[model samples]
Target: MSVLVVGASAAGLSTVESLRRKGYREPITVLGAEWHLPYDRPPLSKQFLCGDWDEDRTRLRPDTMLSALEAEFVLGDSAVGLDVERRTVHTASGRELQADAVVIATGLRARVLPDQGGLDGVHVLRTLDDAAALRKDLLEASRVVVVGDGVLGAEIAATARKMGLSVTMAGPQAAPLQSQFGPVVAGLLEELHASEGVHLKLGTAVTGLTDEDGRVTGVRLETGEVLPADVVVVALGAVPATDWLADSGLRLDNGVVCDARCRAAEGIYAAGDVARWQHEDSLLRLENRTNATEQAACVAANILGDAQPYRPVPYFWTDQFATKIQVHGRPSEAAEVTVAEGNLDERRFVVHYRRDRRVVAVLGWNMPKQTRLHRHHLVHA
Candidate 1:
């Protein structure tokens, strides 16, 4: 049996490794558009941008690790099409590979401001190349403007502030991460950034970008105000890289829809940001590393006839401005949230999301023990 994986990021690499660990020993091949090995992306905007880590340190697995698994690595090549019926993947390099099972872990790509004329100092943090370019500019930039108030944008702004740059965040929302954490918690985040000397231009829209000689100079807001920006980073979230599978006959909504077993179609499976699975009669997709690894393991086990469903609790972590935030399980809108430990003013606390007096999720800041305790409750609740 031969297994083909379309991506070589966390999801793809984890799936391949898990399958090998299960003693399948099939002819596994991993395809990636990037030449670099699978690497952790969370550091791209934090340690890596701050010059605290190098590429070698960010890599998920060393060369020896891939070699030990006997998996073929096809770097700098993209999977352009999939023959679902025949179980073949057509690559952009004019190679068609046969497979017994295929895993589409194409993940996601950063959303770019295309109409902004692709200014030299404007970038999106997604790939290693994007990080490298932004890092170079960040080292010398005095003023930085970040578009979007999502987790990625917030992290970038925090890092820029730490680097002594005058950071300005512009987003349509009232506060950073308001949609995810609600207005109250997001207001706290806004206050946190404000205390760090970062300017917040919330509930605003960008009209266009100002450039001089192809270099970004500032951003023009819809309010007719121009903000000076030596560097601009757009973190408007990501879109799944599933355009290649358009004609593959697989159901695609926000992502490739899959069953509880991670099965997209016969002889095909998907995990990671590209896979949307049925969860409690609702379709859900996660864009976190932890979910990718867990789902991949579940898919591997099911592929080997384990017959187990993929239903692990979602978990994610982010480090920004020296604050370590960890989230376990999915927090629904109707969940009753309460501060379980520490104080938000102290920047150390755990927020528990409860439903029917049972904890369903927890968010912690520098409180691992409390987070773990609530995580256990979430798992068994």
Candidate 2:
């Protein structure tokens, strides 16, 4: 049975590798829209943008390694439509490929501001191309305005500060990462950014952009304030890249809906940011590299006829301003959070989220041992 995988990001690549390791000798075809090989994206905004790492350093697997796997690599070709009835996929390059099974891992695209002029100085970092362009702008930019206060935005703001560029972050929340880290931790993050000379404009919305000669010159906020910026990085987040699956009828909400085994429907599966799976009696979708890789392995195993379910704890990590933030498990809304080590003043600590007297999630900064202990506790709990 031949297996066809669409996309070359973390999920697709993981699925291929896992399948190969499981002794699947059938024809495996990997199709991707980008020309480059599958590469790690976590370092794009941090190390790559800061000029601390080169392109070779960001690659997840070298071409020689991928070729050794005996998988057919089709680059620069996007899967435009899926013929589920016939178990085939139509590519943008006018090729129809039939497969015994298919995996959709298209991932996501960077969210851009709407109704605003697409100027030259506005940037969004998602792909390698995006990171390269932003890195070029950062080299000569004196001031930068970042929209959104999520992990990506926070990293960009911190990187810009390190490069000696004045940064102003605008978001609707009261503080950065309020939704994920809680208000108290967000406050600490705000203090960290403030210490590095980052201007925080929380509880504000960017109404529009001011342009000169078709290039962005500044941003106009809802409060009628125009913030001058030589470069603008819109890190609002990402949306699933499933527009091509509009007529596929494989169940899609925020992403391609799947079961706990990463199976969407008969003969089809999905993994990565573009996949929403049933977890904890609800549809949960994670847009992190860890989730993508884990889910991909699940898909591969199931495809090999091993009916093993995917039960991950939902872990993620981010490095910003020389600070490493690691998260393990999904914190329930009713979970009570507690600090286990260090404090905000020390700039290093571990926060544990407990649900029903059992630690379910742990977030740590420079506290690897504590993080590992909590992770073990959750796994055995």
What local distance difference test score does each model get? 0.88, 0.88
lDDT of 2 at 79: 90
CA deviation > 4 Å runs, candidate 2 = 332-335, 355-358
lDDT of 2 by residue, 258-352 (tens): 98888888889999999998886989899999998899989999998888777888889877776788899876435677888887678788888
Question: How well does candidate 1 score on lDDT at residue 227?
Answer: 92
Which 10 consecutive residues of model 1 have the lowest summed lDDT?
110-119
lDDT of 1 at 186: 75
Q: Model 2 TM-score?
A: 0.96
Model 1, residue 221: distance off in Å is 2.0
- Summed backbone clashes in each candidate are 0, 0
How would you encode candidate 1's per-residue C-alpha lDDT over 319-368 as one tens digit per residue?
Answer: 77867788898765467778988998888899987788988889898887
